[model samples]
Target chain A: MHGMINKSIEDLVTIQFGADKWEAVKKKAGVTETAFVSNQSYPDAMTYGLVGAATEVLGLTADQVLYAFGEFWVTHTAFKGYGDMLMSAGRTIGEFLDYLPLFHTRVALIFPNLKPPRFECSDRHENGITLHYFSDRPGLSMVVVGMLNGISKLYKTPAVVTHTKFKDKGADHDEFLVNWGAADQK
Target chain B: MTDSAPMLDHGQFSKLFPFHFIVDADMRVIDTGSVLARVCPKIVPGALINDHFLLFRLASEPIKAFNRDFIARQENTLFVFKSTSTDLMLRCQVLILRDPERYLFLGSPWVRNPTELKALHLVLQDFALHDSTVDLLQLVQATSTSLHDAKQLSEKLEQRVADRTAELSMANAELSRVMRSKDDFLSAMSHELRTPLNAILGLSESLAEGVYGDMNTKQVKSINTIAESGHHLLALINDLLDIAKIGAGKMELELTKANVEDLCQASLRFVMEQAQKQKINLKLVMDNQSVMLTADERRLKQILVNLLSNAVKFTPNGGSVTLETKCDLESESLMFSVRDTGIGIATEDLKRLFSPFTQLDSKLSRQYAGTGLGLTLVMKLVELHGGSVAVESEIGKGSCFTVRIPCKGLDTLNQHNPSGTISLTEITPAETLPSNTPLILVADDNEINLMTVTDYLRANKLRVIQARDGLEAVKMVREHIPSLVLMDIQMPLMDGLDAIAHLRADDKHTDMPIIALTSRAMVGDRERCIAVGANDYLSKPVNMKQLVKTIRAHLPNDETL
Candidate 1:
């Protein structure tokens, strides 16, 4: 996993919970890192440990923690450099989802060690789309749902997302069905 | 290659280079890319390119011409031009197309700062994906963000440290204020208590001496008890004050060369009566009887006396108490141990023995009445001399308390004297008086004090005069030309300190001895009295014998009676 992802989770915990709680979470996770540099890679197990500790320390489920982190990623100013990158994805949520793979490829150029997950658009409709999320890391379907909602908020389209398939329950990969109001209504 | 081999159409070219423009040999714009046309509306078909734009740089230098020869010479190198209307610098790669012999300028606007991108009405998307300019913009923004965050964090940390320092400073100031108030209270309390006490003890001493008249045996015994109890109370108050002074860091040592044997004899004499009353045997053990020590004479005597007194008090009748002294020349330290073969102290009681007001057993404290401050004072006085005290005791055998004092500097000449005992020198009073009475002036504000002191002096065959205040005292000195003046401090209408200063200013009275007497026994009282020209200082509840002795010591032989 990239440190940018871990840094985003740290920001989420510190901003919402408080810096002391973030320290406890770090200690509970047995992670000695004081500061995480963006565009750097970290052990995937370290990141998973943080999430696991966050669940026990924050008194929240893993899905809830990841969902909050995903929502915070798009809205946080700590990653303002990625604002232009997100803006260059597309004008609306549907266009953005269609261009997600190419966007990740460009992001991989910026973070040379990034192992970006594959995003595919399938079963498209006028007001919705079936999003295929493929990654070696599991148990992050809720993050995708949160990100879709966050994108709808960005585009002012008012979205609702449901996890249609699961990888943790022995499916080949995860999937989310994203639906939104007409763009003109906003 | 054929010109028609699936070449990019106008739309494709416009999308590829949105800021592109083409100019014919006549220097008129033939066509402009759609985006460039919107930015510079005058650069359209058949418009003059030179009128709308300036050739700002050629080979990194300013070029004023956009003619054919100027364009032909700059072929492969980069060129920079600016739109006159927008003041935007455009980096261009020029291509010469043969079909129409036109020069096509293909480029985008150049920007250095991220803020410039916004001011130029450009976004990151305007630059082609292959260009590194957009990445440069991102890096600049990231650097700015990191610097801003670092500055904020530094400021926050500095603020926290400043706050903590301020809190600590406030606490320290408050503690100092409390300590000052406590010292003032102690000084005032001591002064107030001693004023009446001086009269009590002085009159009792006079009564016991039969100054009034001869008394019966019963009266003599009762008077002795009164004197004894008064002395005991004075001791308790002095001990309390000493403890307070030590705790306040105001106690100081007056170091002097003192004969160890003399010191031991003086200390033993203090507790000899008590040991005799209990029938406890007293013994002295030392390697050499003439060994001398460099120490504060008074305080060393006080330390040894306290240990011996405690030893005598705790030991049963017929038990032996011993004073042992050893000098270690190698370590330059002197050790004195007081061991008692009495009912021994329990092991558990030894730890709390030196804590003030702590008695091992309430029953024992009642049985053995004491202030319970002796050991504590001993420990503090020893520490002031850069020394330590240790004790060894058993449940049924006895207890031994040893004090070790380090003395790095001592005069070898005084270290040993062949004489077995050194006699203390004292001032001898005049055996005969002059025909005229010698006048002594006593100044005090309190009536009892004035009467008691004058009565005591008169009984010693001296003519006494009285002054109620410093003003009257000074007047009496000039009027009577008294041989000696006893000045009381803290009087109304000019204090003793001022009175002494006033009298010393006169050449006629400069030779007259003035003794400053005060009820306050504070740390700097004596020094302050002497600083203002007082010949001597005495703390009250004055001992009449010491007072007369001090007067005799300071009086001239011609005047003393």
Candidate 2:
């Protein structure tokens, strides 16, 4: 991933996981990739790549577009991962989504553009499911689809996702929509 | 008629325009206008007009911005200014009458002298500043006076505190001096009473023991009565002094952890002989095994002994005196009771059981001999140990005296050793003194005491030297250098303390062991004797055995004897 994209991921993780949890997630993700990142260092290539993708999609400079993408990605990813983990442990996806507001309320209030992803779990099927949303800007679909794919593999579940076009609505500018269902059923 | 000269002061034109001009605004002298010259003396005809804009700049903006058109049309326009060389301030204003192009018209001058106004202003300013200075000066004077008053007040208070402290110290010193004198007096009195009593007791005991020879029945009885009466008197004296010492707070407790059971048994045994003589059945019923208590062991023993002896003394033939002890584990206290089946205390006399100098009744008084101090001392000692004593009695059922003392834990047991017994094996009577023995000095103020001791020594074939008083004793000690000096505590001219101090102060007699022969059997007398450099002390009417042993103990190379 480009450094800008990685930075967007990190910023998103920070928003989703709080400062403490962000460090843990960063360490865990770094360990998985065998690329050790310290909390103190400058942005890497993956961060730039993510930022570049976000800027192209949002029609903004890398700096302005990177900040929003970082926030949105971190918040949506954490909510989806948390809902999936809860649902896999025999929790109803509806109940998991209902509980999401308690932990993700700060992100929802701070980044109004970021939305909680829809969750789906099926008891009749062997595989669990999750779906996430991202903007349908130039390069975002590829990055978002790839992230959803990676998450699906990471959680050992199937993920379905979609997007919406970004609009200049001042504070309510960016938008997306996601739906998730059990892969076996779908 | 300067009409053709163009009437300079007034207009002769067809229309009268109100315009007036002076070439120079500085001087009152005017060129074309006559009225301007009369109104302002500084305006002059030919002097250049001073620009007013600089003066206008010094004026307040509001006044300087005032409408020139309004002033030109106004009836009166007057500008009053006060000026120094470097500064000018506008003071007042008046209205302008007409436009400047009009014919000249004049009004009376409204000018006030600037020097007078400035002087008055300066005087008013000085008065305001002086008023504050006067107020500050008054305040300073008031504060100084208050400070002086406070210093005087503090000095008086300090003097009062100093005076009170001095008075209190003086009173305390006098009280301490009086107490010392009282202790000295009591000690002297105890010695005086004991000396003669000792002589009587000693002589009687010797006679009863048949030391001189055997006696008939009547003689034996008479001697026995004498010895018994002497002993009783001595006991009474001792009791009264003990009560006095306790009341004076002179008695101190030597606390140790004692086994209450052992102390009670020993005390009971001590009174057993008396119980046997009285034919009273004495028994001990101690249920508590080895219960320990913190106390002065000797004093505790004394208390138990007194109670037991009192029980035995009051009990009639075949009556029983029972000693019982019970332990209260929760309270950690031991209760010792001496119940006697004898002439029981009357309900009315029960209150007097522990009262000093009180016996049961006159009837029992004749039958029993007591100083009545035994019970009082016992109660005092028991109270000292944080304990209490109570009595229960019926007229003929006997009296029971119970003492409750708080108990100490087992760790204190090691501190409670009974006083070591002084062995009498080494001492021999005066009659056993060998012939040709060294001369022994016997000092006693009482002639009877001196005679009795010397007679005993003479009978033993030992040479005797005598002294009438302590001073004489010291004199004799210096002259004779006797083998031993039997020094009396109380004597005329000088007492034992002075004589001993003097003797010990000297080199020759310092090592010569002086045996204190005193009748004062008070608790600290023996300590006092040794403190005054006496080798040992023997109570008056001293047991011949103890006296001889003490003498032998002090003698050099006399161990074989």
Candidate 3:
């Protein structure tokens, strides 16, 4: 995993909770690294260890932690570094989803060792699409759900998202059904 | 063209070079790419290209002319242009196309920073995926974050240091306050203890001198024992007070001219009786008998006496103790050594010899009956005179303690005494008095002190008058015109210094001799008494013989009862 992912998680925990809580989480996880470099690569076990520690320390389910982390990644981490790029990705939410498949391909040029997850959109329409997430790692379907909510918030269109399929339940990959328009403004 | 190859169409070409523009031979805009049209709206298909963009350089140098032929001549050269409409720049390579003679300006937007990218309303996606511009911008941002982290850590460490320094400063101030409090308590205790001791010594002396009545042999021996014990207690109290004063930096020297031979003889005589009691041979050897030193006379004598007493105390029966003095004229210094042949000190025990109240062996303390303060006092007093004391010894041989006092900066050659104190010889009433008795006035708040002094005065056949306080003493002096007055400094109504000042203010009693008496034998007490117009100062408990001599020395020649 890239350090950007762990950095985002650190910023999410530290900003929402306190720095001391992040320290407690790190202690529980037995993580000794104090600061993370953005483009550096870390072992996959570190990220998994952090999620497990956050679950015990913050008294939250792993799914809830991943969901919050995903939302934070879109709302804060990505926007802070690449706000203009985010805005230029699409003029509308459907176009942004259409660009998501090629988003990691463009970013991977800058981060040479990036092992990016794949995103695809099918059954696309004016207000919704079926967002398919494919990755070698398991148990991250909730993060995609949270990222859809973050995108909807960025476009100022309230959204309703449902996990349509899960790889844990013997599906091919994870799938989400997302809908957003003036009809779902609340 | 290859037979099996596919060619790039106009739409494919526009997508490939989205910021490219084509110009005619007349430098007019014939066509513009999609991104160039969107960024600079002024460039149209029919407008003049020179009106929308200015050629900054051709072939990496300043452009000579604004014609298409000049641009075509600069082959394999990079052209730089700044947009007049949006202030965006372009680094381009010109290609000559020969369908109707056109020049294609094929380039992307030239962005060096993130701010420039935003100013041009460009995003990372606007550049082709293979461009390295976005990577450079992200690297810059990461370095800035690292700098920010370092700055924050430095600020936190500085704040921690300031907090720790403040804590240490507060602790140091509290320690100073505690030390001052302890010194004040010791000073107060010294005065309180001496006041009672004064009465005890004064009344006992009067009894021993037969002032009350004649006594039997048994009663006389008991009185002598009580006097001896009282004197011993007085010496211990004085030593304790001296140690406290020196520790507090309140001990001041009263420098005067003193003869070296006289000082040595007095010290040797002081411990002569103890030496005889232990059957030890005491001797004095002086190299220069007439050498004089300008120093604090009392403290110098005390230093010598303390060393001589220690030498005598440590020597066994039938052992020898010697006091040897030498005056080194060239060095302008004096050296005094006290050597003893007894159970000599061990090499390691010599280091602890000058530490206060520490005997080398506890058993030696019991057998020798010593307070163990003699060498400590000797060292301190010698140091007060800017001198050093050294000792050399072996376990079976003798110990020699030598003290070196530097007299280089002192006024040793001038042999005159400048002290204004009256030298009171031991005088009886029959020798000093005339036909009429002298009138003496005694003022004291303590009844025991006043009674003891008055009895001694009357026993000497002097007419005595008593006042309870300084206020009454002042009134008594104005009324009775006594020959001399003895004023106790601490009194109920008024203190002796104030009474003396009040008398000195009056023209009639300006010459009245008022001696200040106090239990506070501290550094500034005598100076304070003299500064307030006291003729002389005496510390209690006063020796009766000495008191009578001081009174006789202060008595007016013609004044009588």
Candidate 4:
């Protein structure tokens, strides 16, 4: 869940989600090598890929992962409350995202349930290499920590918030938190 | 009290009051007079004045409406009176005197009754009706008189119109008759005079041409003079006849488009030869190439020939006669001029140039032999073309005779193509003479004309016989198998046309070529001859050339040997 392995998963999820909204975005983003792999039980391949990847790493079901991802994605992706934003703009959510914040405030009131996550940093040293995790759930602790490390390596920001705190703990809850963390970055 | 002694006279008061009665305010008969009771016994002295308002109705409205005394005393005892005997209504004033309770009254003048007013209105209506009746009568009388006068005036106007119409008709008839007689006289005179003249000309021509025999020089000269004089006289006669015809509105022009230059040249050539003999230089000054003029070509040529020849004749030796032509563009007229540096005419003599038989100088006239009709005929010919001729001259500088003739453009000349050349193929030969050859009897009182015609026939290989007069002509036709005859129309014993008619009646020479040879140049002579069965007519002194041509035309061949 750290290093290349975790970074690959996050990259796949980003490609799947971005391509699902606009097919041309993946090609324009230069991510042709990325492909989706999911649990067959999930109905939508792109959604399953996003959720199953997070779940495998964090230990959560597809529904919990997707819901959490949707919320987090709406709030921090510059496409927050995009559906309601597009409604006010007389366009679709994808069109709202393309237009970005000029229309973001018009729909900011619609996504009241979505909030920014809290952040915690942890370090684990192994084989003389150090690994970091930032998480709000114990269940998704390893996944969130791996994703944050990948983000931090890419953005050079170790202090970035990746998840919100959870009162309960488990792999499912951790997977949810990890998915939420991925949405937040989006 | 003093009046009480006289107040007992009721009968006297009755007569004075007449039919007077008065009423009080409460409808009681407050005062009365005996005369009112006597005038109407039905009205008692106390007859309650129940119908007092009836007095207002009987009175004139103005009097009743404006009675100030009655209007002021509504409750006062008022006196109301009526006089029945006089057909009058009266109202009297009742005044409260003495005690201011007892009433005293005085009667006023009566108002006229409605019945008397109605009678007066009826009398006025009768007068209006009577006056209207008299007016109606007067109007009827006036209208009747006006109608009578109008009828008389109309009749008089109609009579005047009828008289004028009748007078005009009579005048027209008289004018027509006179014109007809004049025409007849001219025709007869032309014929009578021309017949004998033809004989004189014929005989003289024959003598001059030496057809009878040769003669001494003096005799020949005399005969030549006679022939020449006769020919001149004939020309004068022709001119006089033309002038008469033109005056009578009988002369008509045969208009054709002709070449003016050619005509002038030909006319000048004819006269210039004579001018050369007189030592006069006849010159032509022609600037135009050719001008086509619509006119009687023959008459136009006659005019030019006359003027040029006269100019030549009057000019002395070495004098020049010039014929010039100029065109007036504005008027589209061709002005032809014959200017002569000859013995110029006097101003007085210039007026006589176109006058018939009027020569300018008697001495000059004696030198020249002419009928003085040349210029007259020239003027007439010019006038016939709707043109004019004028003369400009001084006594010695010479004279110029200008003729201005209206001209049509050259395009119009195509209508009259003078080169009337007919193809030989169109010339159909005349009918062949009969086997029993027609003995054509030539008759003229003049023996030379007879011989000339017979000799012409003989030269043409035709067996022509002769006669001396119409009687001989008729006799010869009867004696021979004559199929055609040429008879002199004016011969002794019988006229040629009459002889031909008599022969035609006998069925002997009915279809003969009894060509009338006469000097009668009048209009109807040829037609008259043909009417009487003359096959053709030839005017004299007969043109030998034309006579031969006509003879050949009629008798194509001598098949009837």
Interface RMSD of each: 4.3, 41.6, 4.0, 61.8
lDDT of 2 by residue, B1-561 (tens): 346765633443212211134322222324433333333334455543332212232345423233334434543544433332213333223333234432232222122322222322221111122123223322333344345445545775788789999999999899989888888888998989988887888677556656567999999999888887887888778777877788789998877555565566546656755776778776666554445667876677778888887888878888988877776666667788889987787788777778777876777678887877899998888988899999998887888999998875533432333332122222112222445475688888765466557655653445567777888888988887888888988788998877988999998888888999876656798898899899888876666667666776777775224
Clashing pairs in 1: none
CAPRI quality band, candidate 2: incorrect
Candidate 1 lDDT score at position B26: 84
lDDT of 3 by residue, A52-135 (tens): 899898999999999999888889876765566666666667767878887766556556677878888899877788989888
Model 3: docking quality category: incorrect
Residues B473-524, model 1: lDDT tens digits:
8998998888889999878998999999999999999889999997766679
- Sort order, TM-score high to low: 1, 3, 4, 2
Q: What ranges in model 2 sit over 4 Å off?
A: A1-186, B1-165, B214-218, B346-352, B360-363, B410-561
- DockQ per candidate: 0.15, 0.00, 0.15, 0.00
Lowest-lDDT window of 10 residues in candidate 1 chain B? B423-432
Candidate 3 per-residue C-alpha lDDT over B273-294 given as tens digits, one digit per residue, 9 for 90 to 100: 6878999887777665456777
Model 1 spans > 4 angstroms off: A1-151, A157-163, A166-186, B1-81, B87-109, B112-115, B162-245, B248-265, B276-300, B311-374, B390-408, B411-561
User: Which pairs clash inside model 3?
Assistant: none
Residue lDDT tens for model 4, B1-561: 466576646556434543345444434455556534433455554554443323343344423232334534643534454443344344555544333233334453342322232322211111122123223322333334345445555776788789999999999999989988988888888888777877898787656555567899999989888877776777777778877887788888877566666666556656654776778776666555355677776577778878887888878888988888776666778888999987788887677678888887788778987878888888887888899999998887888999999875634433333432222223221212334554456677664455456545644545556666778777878887554677777777888877878888886555566678876666798899989887789887776778766765665365343
**Between prediction 2 and prediction 3, which has the larger TM-score?**
3
Per-residue C-alpha lDDT of model 2 across residues A68-131, encoded as one tens digit per residue: 5543543454333232222322123233333333323332332344343322222322333232
Q: How accurately is candidate 2 docked according to DockQ?
A: 0.00
lDDT of each: 0.78, 0.57, 0.77, 0.55
Better of 2 and 4 by lDDT: 2
